[model samples]
Target: MNTNVTPLTTVSRGGDAVLFAIEMRGKKLTCSITREALEAHFWLERQANEARLLRAFSDGRKRIVAIAERKARRLATEVIKLTSQDFER
Candidate 1:
């Protein structure tokens, strides 16, 4: 239960509330991600954004993968920080 361990979330059932699991230090923290106090939110926007990025870089091959991997890392860090706050509640 070390506060220092970063929480990594995997979101599911995205439609008003998301069922999510956060793992850290070989342990998992389960929680919900709500939209406007509701239990699910549509993930279409996120999917569309990722699709757009992929289409735009369709020809970039290794370059695109590298860039995307970096972006993924940054996004993962951001999400970990965001979800970590849920533990306070």
Candidate 2:
């Protein structure tokens, strides 16, 4: 798949939304996220900051969570395709 999506963001009082646009094979596709589900991503990305406060922690040897995030990324990727599955009223 020749796919590349650069996320652009807009922040507001309620929350944020990311826009992804793609052009491929003479076709244009756009994805608008009304209410971004950011909890999982924010939490996962906070490991570096949290490390300073905690003295000891586990490295999460098992990669169970990757399975879920992988699926999540796939869903988000599909949005760039402008697939009906990601459309919202």
Off by over 4 Å in 1: 1-15, 37-89
Model 1, span 24-55: residue lDDT tens: 34544343433322211122233344343223
lDDT of 2 by residue, 1-89 (tens): 34333343223333333344443334445543323223232222332332321111122211212322333457554333221233222
**Candidate 1's error at 64, in angstroms?**
24
TM-score for each predicted model, relative to the true structure: 0.26, 0.32
State the weakest 10-residue window (summed lDDT) of model 2: 53-62
Model 1: residue 69 alpha-carbon error in angstroms: 21
Off by over 4 Å in 2: 6-15, 41-89
The models' CA-based lDDT, in order, is: 0.32, 0.31
How well does model 1 score by local distance difference test? 0.32
The CA lDDT at 26 in model 2 is 41
* Steric clash pairs (candidate 2): none
Q: TM-score of the candidate numbered 2?
A: 0.32
